[model samples]
Target: MIWLVTSICIQIICAVHVIRTGRNQIWMLFIFLFSLLGCFAYLMLEVMPAYWGNRHLRTARAQVAGKVDPERDVRRAQRDLELADTAANHIALGDAQAARGRYAEAEAAYRKGLALGPGNDWGTQVKLAQVLFERGSSREALTLLDGVPEVSRGSEWDRRGLLRARLLADLGRDAEARALFEDVMSRIAGEEARCHYAAFLIERDDRVRARQVLEEVEQRARRLDRTQRVAQADMYRWAGEKLAELRRASA
Candidate 1:
């Protein structure tokens, strides 16, 4: 009798969570049918994630990585640095720091790595530039990228091109900025690049083009697989809101 009552209470709790979260209301059917197991699954899959938020989610990823490899990213990086304080080791440390959202620490680590190589490590320069760009130091970012030779291929080139375009635009070099922005777009930069371009267009008073770009982004996001949408939720949400605002302004 106690078990029966407890199971019912759990089901009720899970159902309420599902409703309040505006989750697939159909999940309530699973809760109603599967009893305690359903409630447990729902709690693990839904309630726990929503409750933990982004910071905790990042922490959880670290924990999972630790379990998969006992010496996870930061720990392994530290171990490597202890054995030999090399540029590669510092780069690893910088990567770990950036992964944990410690941008300032990452910048310092990347700088230390660059100092060791004395301008020979294009990789280190790019990484330091990335952290600087992320922290809103665009001029510093540009200075760092200035030392690195331009790559002819791969995602690294795309990142550098996008950042250069953004920084140029921010500094009011409109002609150069627009050309690079179009280059990024022409290269089929993903949803993120599209979103950034839309924002840039809006800022430059090209609302019609901005609306078109954002509408394309909104459609792409709507077509994303469930798992991808979940992983890219923040970006998708922002783009959707932007599209809606543009639409309403036109109306």
Candidate 2:
């Protein structure tokens, strides 16, 4: 009985880790099914080595010596830097650089933002978390996000929270991530939030709820900012495609 309890606890921990990492559900299931032995096997066969491999990969890929559109990225970074000497500009520059697939630049921008005064700036923290997440450092991202104060809760914070939830889901903490996502959905009635919530529902196989959330998103989109509305339209387009795919799969 104690062994069983231990196994259950290990499974739960593994699930939470997978959810936090945003890893494969199948892998989590395998760990749960095999219990402690399975968990150990997973750690040995997958988790530990993958973590080490990813760390090495990141270190090796840190430097990008390429000559592309030098003016565009530099100018874009400068413009964003000029807008708000705040940490947000650094995040913005990081995002811009990331959009261009310049991971090193993105990291530099995030680090620069972190160096400037308040290292705990919410927006900058989220941007840095995002970059870390993309770089397979979900655990590190979680560590950073964990430090964000509740008093700092806002749209950007909520978005980061959702991202953290997604990471959790990937790591195998589906229940926790689901609860967090639901909380975010409750607070955010906006189109983007609704769309994201719908996606989360779909992931959980809650098709009906997902559909309802998408409809709500579409309705709310009508009253949002022009840019947000456009983004909503794009979300709807993607939702439509997903719906079609689901239908076809069901059929």
Candidate 3:
């Protein structure tokens, strides 16, 4: 009696769920006619996949939506900040704001992240300096970079190095910037750095070496894997343009 009642209850619950889900009428028929076996089939074939698929889609959509409407994240983070102004959270918001060209807001958020103490002081400074650099605050940007204490071979190092190199070039510290590029050549593994070095060489009237470097950059760009190619698409194009320019100049 107990077993029979339990089977009926399971079938009824699954049948109503399937019906409300608005799936094939066949599912309701199977549930009503086949009982527990039908419920099991419905769960395996429809319920589980629908649940998991919706989960993945929700996660993917949220991530994509963040990029689509950058301000949406800012608002969400602000709400969180109202309750708990954690350093990590502030940095995340700052990053989003920075990506959207809201440098002032990003700067404030990064400063708050820094003041929150020990969230990610090094990273926060790098991002803040990036904003300052974009805004033509070169000296301030350099100061933040100089305060970083150490420079190593990592994505962070590449970022700081690129900014530092550009600052040096803009301030007419060509020698230092060229030397920095040479250092970067040893540390980084992309054609873009070489392209920058080639430009510096071109500026110095070393056309031969510049041509050689550009050719090498072209070869390297051609050899990049799919992931690297995506990462260096702009650089690849720049190097190709530089190569063509060099050729015409030589011709």
Candidate 4:
């Protein structure tokens, strides 16, 4: 009896969804007449495609693929590079290497791309600088960033500035780093800059200001849609965890 009731309820729900979503009224008939099978058909035929296309699901699929074959992207990138010894191919391989934390290989690929005269010289330079910074060459990274075009703007510009700021902070140029941090954070809508700034403040024992910055991240997170939230879920979670730790310490 319970099974029958549940199946009927599911059929009714599916029928209603088909109607409300305008997903072919024929699905409603198929749903009601065929019971659970009809609901399954509706889900498979009507609902699943939309869900599969969701950004979170796409991200999950990529992550699963990465875990299943850790070096899949690197192999694919190398294959492309072998097929075409082009600047973009080198950069792509570098990106794949960087994603896998093979910083030395990534730096080599980025340099080759730059040597081949990449269409986006600044972009390749920034990637090389990032890999250099990751490999403990902050001064060299800073020099590369210093040569980026002055007209750069948007996300790439923000990334370049954030990296330079981090390099500066590591080099004990706190005042310069702070100024750059503030400038980059003001230009972007995301929490990455703010999170980095909060970390910098925490390092300096300015927990109060750090807490305020983290609280602001929390507030912004609350307003984000599901896709946006999922995209930066790690940073948002880190902000929340850091904020809790700060509160505990103050208490």
lDDT of 4 by residue, 76-186 (tens): 899999999998899999999999999999999999988897356887888899999999999999998888787558787787789989999989999999999989988
Candidate 3's TM-score reads 0.62
Better of 1 and 3 by TM-score: 1
What local distance difference test score does each model get?
0.78, 0.69, 0.77, 0.85
Note the residue pairs that clash in candidate 4: none
Clashes of 4: 0
Per-candidate Cα RMSD to the true structure, in Å, reads 9.7, 20.1, 11.5, 8.9
- Please, what are the lDDT tens digits per residue for candidate 3 over residues 1-251? 99999999999899889678875566777687888987876676556643465554444444434443447767777788788879888888888788788898888888888998764478779888888877788888888888886766697777678779977876789889988887877667666678778878888888888889889887776776655565456777877887898899989
Off by more than 4 A, model 4: 1-57, 118-120
Error of 3 at 30 (Å): 36
Candidate 3 clashes between residue pairs 3 or more apart in a chain or in different chains:
none
**TM-score per candidate, chains pooled:** 0.68, 0.56, 0.62, 0.73
Report how far off residue 125 is in candidate 3 (Å). Answer: 1.3
Q: Deviation in angstroms for 230 in model 1?
A: 1.8
Highest-scoring model, lDDT: 4
Q: Give the Cα-based TM-score of candidate 2 against the true structure.
A: 0.56
**Native-referenced Cα lDDT, model 4:** 0.85
Residues 136-170, candidate 1: write the lDDT tens digits: 89898888788788788767788888878888877
